[model samples]
Target: MIVIINYGSGNLKSIKNGFTKIGEETVISQDIREMEKADALVLPGVGAFGTAMEHLESYKDIIHEHINNGKPFLGVCLGLQVLFTKSQENKGVKGLDIFKGEVMKIPEEGLKIPHMGWNNLKIVNECSILDGIENDYMYFVHSYYAKPDDEDIIAATTNYGIDLTAAVCRDNVFATQFHPEKSGEVGLNILKNFVKSIPSK
Candidate 1:
């Protein structure tokens, strides 16, 4: 079963419904024990960086423990941002520190603050999450993006005057700055790819 972390900061229903539409069983929960038993985990969020981290801290042990166990994990939007070392959105607020990186606001230069529309992703390093999908357009709604210390984790990128990390993955850990749930058919395919990646032992 796919367990989506519910820290009161994500588009929970839409995400859950997306998975259901694809015939994948998903459960939204903040309970640590339930998360520990999940086959894979999906961290979905839509809110401020500091507030999201605060909720995540309440279940930090569960988050860390799952990663330590090497379970396949996926993070979306602010969910993806929090995996980094820090974020500028919340001054002096530390992220989960799972990956060595920092999130920063997109430079304002003619473009809007919150990039709220469809954008094409430039695939860097191919991964399972993007299987069957080429460099396609996905929906996005965020003011900040992640800059990883290691370039290898960047699976894809998008341009908005400046290049942005659209998706990232290091080992079993994965994250996307775009909301695949709202990206249309291509996005649903990404979620399906993730579901298929669940390790069977």
Candidate 2:
């Protein structure tokens, strides 16, 4: 079973519907026991970084355990931000630190604050979640983006004034700054790839 972590800060239904559209079923739950038994874990959110992390406090340890055990994990939007060390979005509030990095606001040098709309991806490195998906447009909606301490983990990028981190992957962990669920066929393909990454049980 796939579990989409519901910490009171995400488009849970849209994510679940996306999975369902691809002939996969998902459960949206915050119950530790439910998450513990999931084949794959998905963290999808659209909200303030600090607030999301606070609500996710209970699942921190379990999330770490899931990732450390080599289980497939996917994070989207604010979900992706929380995987980092910290963020300028909410100073002093530490992130999950799954990937050593900091989130910063999109530079406001005659550019838009929140980069919303469609943008194509520049595949930086091969990541399972991006299988059969390259240079395809994906939907984005955010003002903050992650800057990993190690560039090696960057999987894809999209330019919006400055080259922004579009997606990241490290071992069993994967995340996207954009919303795959809202990216049409390209998004569904991404989710399908994620489903394929799950181990057979």
Candidate 3:
């Protein structure tokens, strides 16, 4: 089953509903044991960086163990940010360090601070999670974005002031700055792709 990590963040219900609509078995839980046994993990979050990090640190062992085991894992929005080495949003708070990178605020050009709208993704590295989906629009609502040291991990990018990493995957770990759950049909398809890509339990 797909386990959605619940760390007192909003948007859990919508994520669950999206998976349900796709006929995928999913569970939202904060229990470490449940997370450990999950076939795949979906880290979903919508909140400040520091607070989210605190909640995640409580179950660091479970998360680290899962990723180390090469299990399929996906992070959404702030969930994506916390997988990096650090984030500037929370006064330079340290992240899980799963990947060598840092999160920085999206360059505020003439556009708004929080990029809240549909944006087209520029797919870079083709992967299973983006299978059957061309360059389509995805929903995003965030002020920060990840900058990985390894450009090869970037699966897709979106242009704002500059080209920002929209989706990234390194081995079993995958993440999207945009909320696929809220991106309508294309978004649902992305989640479906992830579900199908999960290794059998």
Candidate 4:
């Protein structure tokens, strides 16, 4: 079964509902044992970077181990940011480092600081999580976005004053800066894609 990590940062209920709507049963837990046995892990968050990292400290190793074992992983919004090395939102706070990258604030060039709205993605590369999703509008709510050291990991981007990273994928790790759970039908489809990518357990 898929486990939605309840690390005291994510919109737990909404994320759970999203998966439920897609007809996928999931477990929300902070238990290390439960996490270790999960078929896939979903990291959904909506909060400050440093606080999220602080709360996630205990589960760091398990998260890495999950990915290292080639298990599916999907992160969203703030969840996506923490996958990088560090975030401008939280100075000096180390991230999961699952992908070598830095999360930087969206340049406020007269545009709103937190890009809160629907934006169509520009697919950059092929990723199983984005199998059938292309140029579709996805709900985004974030002030910072990740800039991976390897551009090849960038799966899709959306224009918000600048071309902000909309999603990223590297092997079993897949993350979305947008909240697919809040993106309506398109979002549900994206979640479905993620579920499909999970190897049968």
In candidate 4, what residue range of length 10 has the lowest lDDT sum?
A: 192-201
Quote model 1's TM-score.
0.97
TM-score of 4: 0.98
Mind giving the per-residue lDDT tens digits that candidate 3 earns over 107-140? 8878898988999999899878898877799998
Best-matching candidate per TM-score: 2
Error of 4 at 121 (Å): 0.5
The alpha-carbon RMSD values of the candidates against the true structure, listed in the order shown, are: 1.1, 0.8, 1.1, 0.9
Clashing pairs in 2: none
Which segments of candidate 1 are over 4 A away from where they belong? Answer: none
TM-score of each: 0.97, 0.98, 0.97, 0.98
List candidate 4 stretches off by more than 4 Å. none
If both were scored by TM-score, which would come out higher, candidate 1 or candidate 3?
1
The local lDDT score (0 to 100) that residue 118 gets in candidate 1 is: 92
lDDT of 4 by residue, 1-201 (tens): 999999988678988999999899999998999999999999999999999999999999999999999999999998899999999988999999988989998999899878999999999999988888889999999899999999999999999888999999988899999998899988988889899878793
Backbone clashes (count) for model 2:
0
Give the clashing pairs for model 1: none
**Candidate 1 lDDT (Cα, 0 to 1):** 0.91
TM-score ranking, best first:
2, 4, 1, 3
lDDT value for model 4 = 0.92
Residue lDDT tens for model 2, 1-201: 999999998679999999999999899998999999989999998989999989999999999999999999999999999999999999999999999989999998998879999999999999999999889999999999999999989999999999999999998899999999999998999999898889883
10 residues in a row with least lDDT, candidate 1: 192-201
In candidate 2, stretches whose alpha carbon ends up further than 4 angstroms from where it belongs are: none
| Best prediction by lDDT | 2
